[model samples]
Target: MTAVKFLSDEYLDELGDLVTPDLPEVPHVNVRLQFHATDTPEGEVDYHLVAERGVVVRAGRGLLADSDLAIRASYRDLLAFESGELHAATAFVTGQFAVTGDRAKVLDLMVVLQSGNYQRFIADLWARTTW
Candidate 1:
């Protein structure tokens, strides 16, 4: 298990393969989320993930059509958010994280991510990911 560059094509491929489409034990909401990271060596990085009941079913690089939510931030900030050093809600309120699209979907996604199953899932991925 070599570490993969965060949000790189290989990383997205690996994440696409690893993410469960649905976690029956955890609450989930149907939504599509887009992540955009700026200020990287590669310029801007874009990825979209489709979730069916809170778990990612499809994750790919580039913009996704009709995403229910789009979240953007500097790569450094995103790194902190991913590592749990930055709380998204607080960051959003502080203007550190920018989010757009359906407000309901944003709230729903938050709920799903806070679930214990999702926490463990994120931890596993974080451990395997390279900064």
Candidate 2:
């Protein structure tokens, strides 16, 4: 998975494994990711995550029919966050990360983000990614 392109099909496909196990503590959270990167073929891509009973059963491209939250950000910023170079709070406060939709969902994501599991997952993903 080295030299991976940002938000490419392969990247998005692999996201499910990394993200699913990290949400074991929260089961009712669903979110949509709107990724925008300058070099992407379409300049943007979308993904949705649906976790139930602490497991992610569905995660793929496009928005869910009804989503709990929408987390949007540039490709670089997202990479930075996942790489631990950009703090989530700093990214949000600096406008690098924009979150919308249900507050409860956001809270659940926040919990995951605060946990070491998320950090480990991010690190693993970053390791697999080339840039």
* Candidate achieving the largest TM-score: 1
Per-residue CA lDDT of model 1 for 5-54, tens digit only, reads 77777776766664665566335477788989899766799987776766
Which one is best on lDDT? 1
What overall lDDT goes with each candidate model? 0.77, 0.64
**Runs off by more than 4 Å, candidate 1:** 25-28
Q: For each candidate, what TM-score against the reference?
A: 0.85, 0.73
The lowest-lDDT stretch of 10 consecutive residues in candidate 1 is 18-27
Residues 95-115 of candidate 2 have per-residue lDDT tens digits of 787777775666566655666
**lDDT score of residue 24 within candidate 1:** 69
Q: What is the lDDT of residue 117 in candidate 1?
A: 62
In model 2, what is the error at residue 110, expressed in angstroms? 0.9
C-alpha lDDT of candidate 2 relative to the true structure: 0.64
